[model samples]
Target: MTSPRPHERLLASMMRALPESGIVLFGADSVFPMIAIFAARRWGKNLTVVSAVNTIDPRPDFLPYSTMDPPAGHRGSYVIPMAEAYDLVGRGEVDHIFVSAAQIDAHGALNSSVIRMDDGPDKRLPGGGGLAMILRTVSVVDAWKPVHLRRTFPPRVDFVTGVGNLRHVITPMAIMTMEEEELRVSSIRSGDTLDKVQDATEFTLQLTTKESGLSRAIAEPTAEEIDCIERVDPRGVRYATEVY
Candidate 1:
């Protein structure tokens, strides 16, 4: 069997962060909705996807560019206003939410707003549409970044758009979690090392240990998980670069 690609392994890692039986609300990004659907199918009958477009429970046949895209909500059981969905989050009905950031800090505060520049015009990113409320209310927030770079994981974000319930930070190279209110390297991806992760990150890398007193590391994506990702996203939408 062929080895799993970085995105596939990242997707599998994201899937593991999800609850087996709860409503998972996905953010309006390129990759996470696909992961949400895979988790729903793999876990079977227990996982429900509340798409970013407010679809109650969508089972999209193919991956969409953004979760807010209409095709992402295709074949859904029903639709509800986004306000209602936020209500669900406020009521603690939603167990988990997937969020992304243009920049994230050591404290897990996110910046989806503008990137400050001293020499030139500041770059305005896609501002947090509803991230402030969702991040604050959701029980768990799993953030993913396709690229693992020093600028992406900074010691402090340029602007704080959201900062609540951020439990895990998933990137192409590693999986980090909150420890003592600071982001720590919980698991390095298979074939990746702490030195590589630290080189890509702006802050110091602190390794987390398992209950058995061993270091935590990401398991290679199982063959079954790779197969599911391939089946759902043959066009490789998950690998596409974000416009913003």
Candidate 2:
């Protein structure tokens, strides 16, 4: 199997930090989190991966590339309506929620609503399918963006689909969490520097204590983690999404 890509490695790093057992929900169409669920399962995390379209606890090989596609085989253990799936969030049963981001600000506010470029405003995005409810209900909300660049990580978002529940933001180069309601760098991907992360982010990012003349070092991806990604995504689909 080939090596994992930057985003895959970042996802694996974030997912590995989850507690051993809990109900984890992925955004409707995101695939990298799906790969994390499979990787967590492979490592015997003993957590349930729930989805409304496909089956719960879906096998890696059985999973499809997009939500619009049909499950290949043995999709999952059970199927439920999308409404019922969100009900889990309402009841506070979900421990962690991962959603995609069109734009994220320094305050962890997310904008998956519409794209307003300098030339002109774009059409309203499909927006967060059920993310508003999840944000209000779940304690731990994570935002994942495949593209890690200035345009994507703007200082402010055009709209706020959800607010005040962000725990971490995972991008191709780094993993960030809120520190005192502001974005702070927690861990960076292997070979990536803090300066690189600061440059990519449009907002000012708080450095970890270690980065600010402290006697500690930020953690980077390990060999075992890259191996885990290889095992979970041997075909490199998760990594390929970064390019295409």
What's each prediction's TM-score? 0.90, 0.85
Task: Summarize candidate 2's per-residue lDDT along 1-244 as a digit string, tens digits.
Answer: 3555566566666666555888887656767777776677677688787754545766645456764455521457777666777777889888886787788888878888888777876768988776677777886777877767887787888888878678778777777877777888887766778898898989887765434221223344456666666687677667557621
After the best TM-score superposition of candidate 1, give how far the Cα of residue 221 lies from its true spot, in angstroms. 0.9
Candidate 1, run of 10 with poorest lDDT: 207-216
The Cα error of candidate 2 at residue 183, in Å, is 0.7
* Model 1 TM-score on a 0 to 1 scale: 0.90
Candidate 1 lDDT by residue in tens digits, 19-107: 76778877666455455456546645377778777787787777777766787777889897978887888888888877888999999
Runs with alpha carbons beyond 4 Å of true place in candidate 1 = 43-45, 209-215, 242-244
lDDT scores in order = 0.78, 0.70
TM-score of 2: 0.85
